[model samples]
Target: MLIHLAYTLTGDRRCAELQRMDSERLDMSGYAYYENIWGGGAESMFRRKASVVQHLDRLRVGEHSLFEIDDFIVNGGEGPGQQDEHRRLFAPAVDLNFRRFEQDRRAYLEGGAERQADEEAALMRWLPHCRRKLFFEWNAPELVNRLIPFLYLDTYLSLLRAERSTIEQVRRDLVLGLNRAFSHLYLTDSDNLYVTTQYLHSAEQPRPLVRLTIPLSGVDLFVDGRPDMAYDRERPDLLLRFAPPPALALRPGAPMPKLERWRLNLLTFEYLMRLAHGGTYNILADECELSVRALKDQLLSAFAYEPAEAGLIEFFVAERRRYVLKKIQIDEQGHLRSGG
Candidate 1:
């Protein structure tokens, strides 16, 4: 279904390759739905708890589970008209939940801790049934937008096992992750943006000012427009307060605004590791007609040290080698830092 949707959206025949790749990646089941469900389950649960994070096809009404409705449509002893009628029966409830979901989403974004907690609880209570709503209404513009943030948030939350974290901590992580996601989307040329703790500055004289932008690209709602980095040409001084970045101070219900070059977040690191260790990188190297070492050097430039920044990137490299490649053992302690 998703591959069909992808092909429909992009009209690219290559989208069919996703099916082939997914099949290759999975076991004899010939499908990856279960692995995806289990592998990303915590992230999905966290995103759902955080906000309404689902596409239209995934939406459910109270008590009328998707599977039940799907069965109804397939074998409800009903004709097309009857199935349409049954589907419409749940439409009002779905609409109501959508409105409420959007309202709570706005409240969570605009409200403080108390309001956020209240909304979270309300949404949690609404989950079992609201998640089961079934309908074919594609009227909601925000559905697709809601879906994107769920995946983007996982880029950060999964690394830390965010399900165990406090509400405040989860919100903080979401804010940071969303910023990282939109920054990459608006600023970089690559689809896979490598977000790192490291920062870079230009060496040219009278260096052009790079505005730190916080683009909320469908953070919880569908943003109709794209981020225009050209708009930031006026506010170069925004770089001074890069610590939190402007996304932290964005007013409630603020519009999406619009990076620097070359960053590497942990998500990208893990992906690269999997590719290299799984031999995918070697296949890519072979296909590209480039030496593996040469291919790696091209990517390594993003992690390389610049004269302006500290050696944090170097520290990351060393630690990755020690803990990952060498599996070095450290002196165990009783604290949280200690090896369990």
Candidate 2:
């Protein structure tokens, strides 16, 4: 029935009787869930509108730009049964209706309805599917961030193969976008979580080595009823402290032998220095004779001595480029010079 109506509408059918019936049905049943969710009253409508507006503003976009009708309906999380009924009853003719509406808006300005009619015709031919509904409803920033990578993975891979951009740069951008979106939606009260990359090339493909750093003040980590030691805000050293379980004895000095500790510290220092100079993890692992897993475990454990403080140290170091770049200037001859 919907397909038939869509075909008719797209073909510019002048069936007033059919149009009136479809419009009435849509008004009565298709939007019933929206009314129910907003509570079929004036007050509820206002509240729903306000909530939507607030969410839109937080997304840093205008209301219409933030979401389409499909996004609104799908994110509402109505039951599957209701959705199926709606699709079966009215969805066939209204496939991509929101997109068509946008076209119609443009047509109204350009003095032509041809594009709008074409879109409506295309929608009619394309059967509305559950996946479309899913896309519409999952509108949260965090959700979009998480899904965008997967959605664009094929395009990204294609671009990588074409050598349009370096893999490392692409991975860095992906991590930054993911972290920014996550922070915006879930960590609203917390500062941005900076992501640093350590890229490693495998036999088959390259992988991103990711490090997440959140501000010490933004996180609360407690062990054995004691607050974790704070890191020096100005330093690059991360201090991580963890309480030993009752079964493990607490030692004041280093956990490993002195020789081993010294070796590990040297390795760690070299790795940190290389990372500061924009070195890749592949280079570090090769130089230090450490497996990726081993390096990550040791680095994470090293900070456990004073987790909170260490976190801040790492945070500052991770963001060092922002401040450090300004201090280093190049002469016309491309000689590097440092300012006091």
RMSD per model, one decimal:
21.4, 19.6
Give a tens-digit lDDT track for model 1, residues 238-301.
Answer: 0001122343334466443221222233334333333423323332233232322242344333
- Candidate 2 Cα errors over 4 Å, as ranges: 1-31, 38-42, 45-340
Clashing pairs in 1: 60-132, 60-133, 61-132, 61-133, 194-263, 195-264, 195-265, 196-264, 196-265
Over 216-318, each residue of candidate 2 has an lDDT whose tens digit, in order, gives 2322221112233453233222212222321122345546311101122224333433443344454435445343235335433443343221212221112
lDDT of candidate 2 vs native? 0.34
What lDDT does the true structure give each of the candidates?
0.32, 0.34
Best by TM-score: 2
Error of 2 at 103 (Å): 17
Instruction: For model 2, give the 10-residue run with minimal summed lDDT.
Output: 257-266
